[model samples]
Target: MGEVKVVFQSVDEVMDYLKALEGYSGDLDLQCDHMIVDGKSLLGILSLGVNRLLNLQIYSDNYEELIKKIEFCCRG
Candidate 1:
């Protein structure tokens, strides 16, 4: 398991991240307050009310690449 901290600026970025994550075969988890959702779910991510200081956990052999892709959204 790997953990990364990131902030989402908009819904579009989140959608992009989700799209990129479609290629990853891993268990990705995003947590905000007490809510936990799949990192690959656009609807699930949007419902978190994520704005800043969101911690994402990418679990799998490809976690390093997944983290990089998700970090891409922080800039968007």
Candidate 2:
């Protein structure tokens, strides 16, 4: 497993980030406070109340691709 720290400027950015990761072959989880939610789940992400910094854990075989994609999405 690998980790990356990201921050979303707005609710729309969070939603868009999740949307862009659609069809990714591995598991992704984002944590904030004490909450952990599925990165691929828009509803779960929205429920995360994400604003500002979020910590992400990428549990995937292709850690490089997952990190790259996540970084691209959350880059603002």
What TM-score goes with each of the models?
A: 0.82, 0.77
lDDT of 1 by residue, 1-76 (tens): 8888767788777777778777678787878888888877777788887576667887776677766666675432
Total backbone clashes of candidate 1, pairs 3 or more residues apart or in separate chains: 0
lDDT of 2 at 24: 79
Clashing pairs in 2: none
RMSD per candidate (Å) reads: 2.5, 2.4
> Model 1: clashing residue pairs?
none
How do the residues 1-76 of candidate 2 rate in per-residue lDDT, one tens digit apiece?
8778787767788766877677877788888888988877878877777564677787876777766766754533
Model 2 lowest lDDT segment of ten: 67-76
Q: How much lDDT does each candidate structure score?
A: 0.74, 0.74
Q: How many residue pairs of model 2 clash at the backbone?
A: 0
